[model samples]
Target: MTFEKQVVLVSGAGRGLGAAIARAFIENGAQVVVNYRRSEAQAKALVEELGQRAVAIQADVSDPLEARRLVNDAAEAFGHHVTTVVNNALGDFSFNGDAREKIQTIGWDDFLGQMDVALHGSLNLIQAAAPAMEAAGWGRIINIGTNLFQNPVVPYHDYTAAKAALLSLTRTAAGDLGPSGITVNMVSGGLLRVTDASAATPEAIFELIAQSTPLRRVTTPAEFADAVLFFASPWSRAVTGQNLVVDGGLVRD
Candidate 1:
C-alpha cells in the first residue's frame, strides 16, 4: 500500500534512529505518530518540524497499559487505526565495546532490561494494534534489530540476546498475523555511524567497520530507515517473517 494511505506509529521516535525513521515516514506521505518515553523537548520539536502530518505522544511501550493507550491515541489523532507499527524503542544502552558488561559480569537484570523494551514492548504493540488491523485487513509491523545476531563483532551479550528474541517474535507474529493481512518483519543494522546510543563508540571502531563493509562506509540512520519503509510499502506486500540487514553488507545474511 502507498504510504499516503497509512497511519504509522514509531516507538522511541524523539531522537536518534527513531527520529530518522519518523522523518522518513512523514516524507513518504504517511501520517506519523512519534512515540517517546522521555525526550519530550526533542519530540515536540520534531512534531513542530513535521507539521500537520506528524504528532508526538509520550508512552512507555514496556508498560502494556501505556502501549495500548498509545495505539488508541494514535488512532484518535489520525482518524484511522494505525496501519504500521515500528518497534524501535530501546532501553538505556550504549555501544562502547570497552564499556559493555562482559558475560561473566553482566547480571540477569541487564538482559531483562533490554527484553522489557525490545521483546515485551513489541508484544504489547502487536497485541494492541492487531485487532484494529484485523478489522481493516491490512497492517505492517517492522521491528528494528541488530546484525550482531550473526556477527556479534562486539559480543554485546545482553543486547544481542534480547534482539535475537525479538527476531523470533517477528517471525512467529508474522505467522499468527498473516491470516489477518498483517505482515511482520525485521530490519537489522550494524554499528550505525552515529546515534545517541552509538555516540560512545570509539571512532576507530567506526572506521574499521566502514573499511570492512563492501560499501566502504558506515550505514546512516536515513539509509537504514529506508529499508524499514520497504516493508510498509506495497513493494513488499508478500514479504513477511523476514529480516533484512541494512549494514552495508557487513553481515551478508
Candidate 2:
C-alpha cells in the first residue's frame, strides 16, 4: 500500500482524474511527475501544492518524441528512473450526449483522433519508459480506461472504441513486459460524477445514472483513482493484464 521511494509519471495529470491520481500517489510517498499537454497552469498549481515531491512537465503523449522527452526529463529532474507510469492522457472530448456525434455521422477521423491519444499515446510512453524500467527490473504501467465499452449506456462510439483498443494493448504489453517485472493493467471507470470533461453532462443524466447504479451514486475521480494506486503498489506485484472497473458496481466485468 506504499509507493515509498517510487518515482511516478502520471500523464495528463494537470486536472480531473489524472490530477486526483497524481495527488494520491504523492500522498502515498511517491515522487510524482505530472505531465500535461496544455494544462500548464493547473499542472503548475498542483506541483506547487504538492511541494518538491512533484514536478510538472508538458508533453503530448501521442507524439513519440515528446513522450521520450517527458520520460527523460522526469528521470533527470527526479534523479531516478520513473518506476511507475499512468497513461491517463486523453484527447479533447466531452460527455455531453447532445454534442456527441452519432456513429453514422461520425467519420473514421473521429475514431482515429481518440486512438491517436488513448492507444498510440500509451504505446509511446511504454516504449520510452521500457528501457529504464527493464534496467530497474520492476515497474508498473497503468492505463486509464472506461467501462463504456462494456455498458455503452450512451454509445459514445469513438471514445468507447478507443478504450476497447487500449484494453487490448494493455494485455499485449503485460505479456511482453512480465518477464522484466513490468506489469501493465487498466483501471476503468464508469461516468465519473465530476471532471472537467464530464462537466458538460446535464444534471438530470447524473441523477438517472445515480439511481441505476448499485452504489446509488456515480463514482468520483478521487474514488476511481485509488484503484490506480493498488496496481502500482507492492500488493499487486503478482497482478497484471487485468482491468478493474470502478463504477459504483454499475458494470461488473
TM-score of each model, in listed order: 0.99, 0.98
* Residue-wise C-alpha lDDT for candidate 2, range 100-121, written one tens digit per residue: 9887798899899999999999
Q: Give the RMSD in angstroms, all C-alphas superposed, for model 1.
A: 0.6
User: Worst lDDT window (10 residues) for model 2?
Assistant: 1-10
Candidate 1: lDDT over CA atoms? 0.96
Model 1 lDDT tens row, 2-91: 999999999999999999999999999999999999999999999999999999999999999999999999999989999999999999
Q: Candidate 2, which segments miss by more than 4 Å at Cα?
A: none
Best by lDDT: 1
List per-prediction Cα lDDT, in the order shown: 0.96, 0.93
Error of 2 at 7 (Å): 0.7
Cα displacement (angstroms), candidate 1, residue 241, comes to 0.3
